[model samples]
Target: MKVAVVLNPIAGGGRLKRHWPEVAASLKRHFGDFELRETQAEGDAERLALDLAAIGFELVIAAGGDGTASEVADGLLKAFRESGRT
Candidate 1:
């Protein structure tokens, strides 16, 4: 499957960034290679997610806290709505 990971480097007080090496290794082991997109600010995750979905990625993962996940979901939903698939 085509997979994309939208990451928030500063989330959890930078805890996610600290552990990302191991997390990425595990994901690669299970899912093979994936596209990784790091968020630079509040709206980045949403934009990344929307673009990934529009480009036919089968999976888009939000690798951050609740807010990041929500943004990714919103983006995907927006993509779906725009495509008339929702």
Candidate 2:
């Protein structure tokens, strides 16, 4: 599955940003290649997820806090609706 990782950089008060290099390396080691988007504002992850879905990614992994994950889910659902996905 082609995965998309939506990251909320401010999730843990910037911890994700601080340790992203290590986390990214680990993801690359495991997942090989994934579409990664670091959220800059509140709704960035959702927009990113919508964009990813618009292009038809098979899998999308929203890596962030509850709110961020929720936003990504919302975006995916919106895209699904717009695309007529069953």
Candidate 3:
């Protein structure tokens, strides 16, 4: 399945950024294809997540802190609800 990883650039004090190569490698092992999106600003993650969900991505993974995760989840949930599949 296709997996989209939404990562916040400022997350974990840039720890995620440092480990992105390793993370992407690990994700490739589990998914046939994947996409990575780095948040450009505070709300970018949520917007990207929502767009992905709206476009029918089966999985949207958030790679960030709780706040970022919550934003992505909210976006996904909103998309799901709007699509009437929840």
Candidate 4:
């Protein structure tokens, strides 16, 4: 399946970026296709998640701390609810 990994570039003080390669490699092994999106600024993660949902991506993975995950989930859930897809 296609997976969109919405990463918070500033998360963990940019430590997340260092581990991205391993994360992407692991995802690639399980998913047919995968894409990475780095957050440019505040709220970017949620915006990216919403955009991914609008583009018909069934699975959007959020990789970050609690705050980042919450933002991504909120955005994805909003999109899912608006689309009436549960």
Candidate 5:
């Protein structure tokens, strides 16, 4: 499967960023090769996820708290809506 991960580097008091190496290793082990995109600001994850979806990524995983997940989902939804899938 084509997988993309949208990570918020400073989420959860930076715990996610600190643990990302191990997390990436586990994801790679289970899912094979995947793309990782880190958010630099508030809207970056949404934009990245939208682009990823537009290019036919099968999955977009949010590696942060609820806000990141929501942004990713919104981007996916926007892509789908624009493509007449919804």
Candidate 6:
């Protein structure tokens, strides 16, 4: 299964950035392999997710707090809406 990981490096004051190596390994163990996309700034995750979804990502995962998750969801919704998918 192809998976997309949208990670916010600045989340929790750079906690994700510090522990990403181990975290990525753990995710790999479970998900096998994934496309990792780092956020350059706020809303980058959303834009990235939207682009991924548009290209046919079956699963998209978002890291960070609720804000990041919300943005990702919004992007996915917008993509689906624009595509006219039910």
Best by TM-score: 1
Q: Which regions in candidate 5 have their CA more than 4 angstroms from the true location?
A: none
* TM, every model: 0.96, 0.86, 0.93, 0.89, 0.95, 0.91
For residues 1-86, could you state the per-residue lDDT of candidate 2 as single tens digits?
A: 68779999888888887898898889888888888888888888889999998998867788878989999999999899999765
Worst 10 residues of 4 by lDDT: 32-41
Please write out the lDDT profile of model 3 over residues 1-86, one tens digit for every residue.
66799999778999988998898898888886888888888888889999998887889999999989999998998898899887
Best by lDDT: 1
In candidate 5, residue 39 scores what lDDT?
96
Worst 10 residues of 3 by lDDT: 29-38
Every candidate's CA RMSD:
0.7, 1.4, 1.0, 1.3, 0.7, 1.1
Candidate 6 lDDT: 0.88
Question: How far out, in Å, is residue 65 in model 1?
Answer: 0.5
Candidate 5 Cα deviation (angstroms), residue 23: 0.3
lDDT of candidate 1 over 1-86, digit per residue (tens): 99999999999999999999999999999899999999999999999999999999989999999989999999999999999976
Ranking by TM-score: 1, 5, 3, 6, 4, 2
Whole-model Cα lDDT of every candidate shown, in order:
0.96, 0.87, 0.88, 0.84, 0.95, 0.88
Stretches of candidate 3 above 4 Å error? Answer: none
Candidate 1 wrongly placed segments (more than 4 Å): none
Model 2 poorest ten-residue lDDT run: 56-65
Segments in model 2 whose C-alpha atoms lie over 4 Å from true places:
none
